[model samples]
Target: MMRNVAILGASGYTGAELVRLIAGHRGLRIAALSADRKAGMRMGEVFPHLRHLDLPPLVRIDEIDMGAIDLVFCALPHATSQAVIASLPRDMKIVDLSADFRLRDAAEYRRWYGQPHAAPELQAEAVYGLTEFYRDEIRAARLVAGTGCNAATGQYALRPLIAAGLIDLDEIVMDLKCGVSGAGRSLKENLLHAELSEGWHPYAVGGIHRHLGEFDQEFSALAGRPVEVQFTPHLVPGNRGILATCYVRGAAGDIHAALAGAYADEPFVLTLPMGEVPSTRHVRGSNYCHLGVVEDRRAGRAIVVAALDNLTKGSSGQALQNANLMLSLEETEGLTMAPLFP
Candidate 1:
C-alpha cells in the first residue's frame, strides 16, 4: 500500500527538493503540500523546475487535512516548525528539516537560537537524524530531527576519528563552503545575482553560527566529554552543495582508514582513495557524501574533506532517509539516484 505523505512549507528550496526526490519513490505519495504565502498557487508556478510533474496545488497549513497523512515532512522555517509540529497528530510520523527539534535540551536551544522552545517534550523525544550514526534510533522514532547541512558535512569528516580516538580533540577545526541554495529561496540582498555572483564571503564567523550548537551537542556526546570544533562557514556563489574541510591531529593514512571503515557499509557516504580530493560539482543534486583524506607535511596533522548536496544529503534527502527508517521502508529506496555531475 502506498503511504501518503504531507509536505509542509513545500514552496521552499528543501521542500521543492523533497517533491523532486519523492517523484521517484514507489512506496510513498505526496498527498499534501502547504506553502502559506504562496497558498492557492501551483507548485509549478512557484518553482518552474518542478512544473513537469503533476502535483497538488499549494495550500495553507490550516487548510490541509492531516488525518489522511501517514507521514509528514516539515520543511518549514526553524521557529515556525515547532508551532506547526506541536499541533500535529501525535501518531503522525515526521521527519523535520528544521532546527526546532535538533537540539536535545530546550535550554541549549534557547541559548543558540535566542528563544525558548515551544515544544520541549517533542525535543526530548525527537531522535537526532544523522541517518548514519543514529540509524537505529531513527528507525524506532516517531519524529526525527535532521542535522544542519554544514553540521552533517563536517561530521562526515570527523565522527569516525572522534569515535575511534584517533584525532586530537583539542585541535579540531572545520572550514565549510556552501552554495546559495543552502540559504533556501529567501530574498536576501546578499543572495542577489549581481551582489553575490562574483563574490564569496564568510558569514557567522567566530563560532557564532547556529550549526555550532549541533556540532557541540553531537560531538560532545560522542566523545563522552566536551568536544568543540572551531567552525567558520563561507557562502560560495553557486546554487548547490557543501564542501567541508576538516583539520585534525592524526596520520593521513589512519584518518583515511577510519573514515573508510566507518562508511564502508553506508550507501550515501563514500570515502575516496587516499590523497584524492572531492569537488562539489561531482555530488551536486544528489544524496551522496564524498569524503577525502590527506596528510599535511607537518608530522601530526591530517586534512579530511567531505562534500554533499546540501539540499539532498544535507537536508531534504536526509529527511527522506530518516523517514524511510521511521516507516520501515528500504533504507536506500528513493535515494539511490546517482549524484549529478558535469
Candidate 2:
C-alpha cells in the first residue's frame, strides 16, 4: 500500500524537491500540499521542473485533512515550523526540513536563533536526521529534524573520525561553500543576480553560523565531551550543492579508513579513494554525498572534502529517506536517480 504524504510549506525549494522525489516514488503518494501565500496555485506554476507530475493544488496547512496523511514533510522556514507543527494531530509522523526542531535544548535554540523554542516537548523528541548516523533513532522517531545542508556536508567528512576516536576533538576547522539555493527560494537583497552573479564571498564568519550548534551537539555527544570547530560558510553564485573542506589533526590513512568503514554499507554516502577529492558538481541533484581524504604537507594533519546537493541529500531527499524508514518502506526507494553530470 502506498503511504499518503502531505507536504507543508510546499512552495519552497526543499518542498519542491520533496514533490519531485516523491512523485517518482512508487511506495509514497503526495496527498496534500500546503503553501500559505501560494495557495490555489498548481505545483508546476511554482516549479516548472516538476510540471511533468500531477500534484495536489497548493493550499494552507489548516485546510489539510490530516486524517488521511500517514506522513507529513514540513519544509517551512526556521522558527516557523514549530508552531505550525505543534498544531497538527499528535499522531502524524513528521520529517521537519527546518531548524526549529533540530536542537534538543531550548536554551541552545534561544542562544543560536535568538528566541526560545516554541514547543519544548516536541523539541526533545525530534531525532537528528543525518540518516546514516541517526538511522536507528529515526526508525522509531515520531518526528525527525533534517540537518543543515552545510552541517550535513561537514559531518559526512568528520563524524566517522570522531566516532572512532581517530582525530583531535578541539582542532577542527570547516570551510564551506554553498550554492545560493541553499538560502531558500525567498527574495533577498544579497541574493539578487545583480548583486550575486560572478561574486563569491563569505558570510556568517566566525562561530556565528547557526549550524555550528548542530556540529557542537552531535560531535560532542559522539566524543563524550564538548567539541567545537571553526566554521565559515561562503555563498557562491550557483543553484544547488554544498562543498565542505574539513581540516583535522589525524593521519590521512586513518581518516580514509574511518570514513570508508563508516559509510561502507550505506547507500547514499560515497568515500572517494585517498588523494582524490569530491566536487559539488558530481553529486548535483542526487541524494549522494562524495567524500575524500588527503594528507596535508604538515605531518599529523589531514584534509577531508565532502560534497552533496544541499537541496536533495541535505534536506528534502533526506526527509523522504526518513519518512520511508518510518513507514517501513525501503530507504532508497525512488531516491536512486543518478547525480546530474555536466
Candidate 3:
C-alpha cells in the first residue's frame, strides 16, 4: 500500500531534500520528478548528494502521468506554482512548498506579491500548513500551503503565547537569521561565494519581507483581530537552518511554561529548559525544531528563540509531515531521524 508521490521542480534545494527524506519513508514511493529545465536528466546530475538513490529521471510537468500519482509536492517558485497546480488533476493531494497559496486573501496576495492571484479558487481552498497548529484542517485538505520558513520559525516561538494571551500582541518583534539555501538554487550575483562568504547583512528591512504577509494572516486569525509583528530576516552564510529570536512583553517563566506545555507531546518540536538557547547547528539537516525562552534584564520582558533546518522543518520536511497526516500515515514517519551533527 505504498502511496506514490512526485516532486515538482525537482532541481531545487527543497525538492532534493524531499527526495532524501522520502528515501527513508516506508509508506511512500517516488514515482516521478519534474524539472522543466532539467527534464531528461537524472536527479543525481542536478544534485550529486542525491546521486546514490535510484530515482526517476527528471521530466516536464506535462510528461508525468498524474493518474498514477497520489500526491504532488510543488517546490516551484512563487508565481509559477499557481498556473502549474491549476493544470493538475482535481483530486490529487498537494503539499505546496511555495508561497503561492500560503495567504488566504487574494487581495493580500496581490498586495504582497504585486500581482493578482492566478488561481483564486485554489487559494481559497489551501489550508495553511503549520502542521502542529492546523493538524485537522491539513489532514482533510486536498491542498495545503506550507508556511514560510521565517514565519514558521517565529510562530513556533510565539504561537502558544499569542494563543494563551501570555504576551503583549502589540509588542512582538522577530529577528531571524537563515541560511542561503532558503533562497533556492537560483543563480544570483549577491549569492556568489565571493560576495556571500565572510559577510552577512540584513535585507527586507522595516517589515517589508514577503513572509510578513504570512505572519499578518496567521497571527491575526489566532488573536481574532489584526496582529502585525515587526519582523526582519537576514541571509547568513550557512548552507541550511533558521534561527528566529523573538522578543515579547511577558514573564519569561510563563513563556517557558506555556511553550513546554504546548509542545510537550509534539514529536518534532522540543521545548528546552528555561534560560537555555537554541542554535541552528544542533537542528541542522533534520525535521526537529528546538525552542527556548529566557528572561530579559528588564522586568516584564522575555526572549524566545527557535531553531530548525530551513530546508527541512521550514519547508520540505514540513511538507512531508503534512503529507503524512493527509495520507493517514504516522505523523512522525520518515521525519524522526536524528538531527545531523558534528
lDDT of each: 0.93, 0.93, 0.95
* Tens digits of per-residue lDDT for model 3, 1-342: 899999999999999999999999999999999998889999999999989999999999988999999999999999999999999999999999999999999999999999999999999999999999999999999999999999999999989999999999999988899999989898999999999999886999997899999889888988999999998899999899999999999999999999999999999999999999999989999999999999999999999999999999999999999999999999999998988887
Give TM-scores for every candidate, taking all chains together and pairing residue i with residue i.
Answer: 0.99, 0.99, 0.99
lDDT of 2 by residue, 50-121 (tens): 888888899988889999999999999998999998998898899999999988989999999999899999
lDDT of 2: 0.93
Which runs in model 2 stand beyond 4 Å of their true positions?
A: none
TM-score of candidate 1 against the unseen true structure: 0.99
Model 1 score (lDDT):
0.93
lDDT of 1 by residue, 1-342 (tens): 899999999999999999999999999999999998899999999999989999999999888899999999999998999989999999989999999999998999999999999999999999999999999999999999999999999988898999999999999989999999988888988888988998888999998999999999989999999998998999999999899999889888888998999999999999999999998998988899999998898998989999999999999999998998889999888999878768
lDDT of 1 at 224: 100
When summed lDDT is taken over every stretch of 10 residues in candidate 1, the lowest stretch is 333-342
Judging by lDDT, tell me the better candidate of 1 and 3: 3
Clashing pairs in 3: none
Q: How should the candidates be ordered by lDDT, best one leading?
A: 3, 2, 1
Displacement of residue 213 (Cα, Å) in model 3 is: 0.6
**Angstrom error at residue 210, model 1:** 0.4
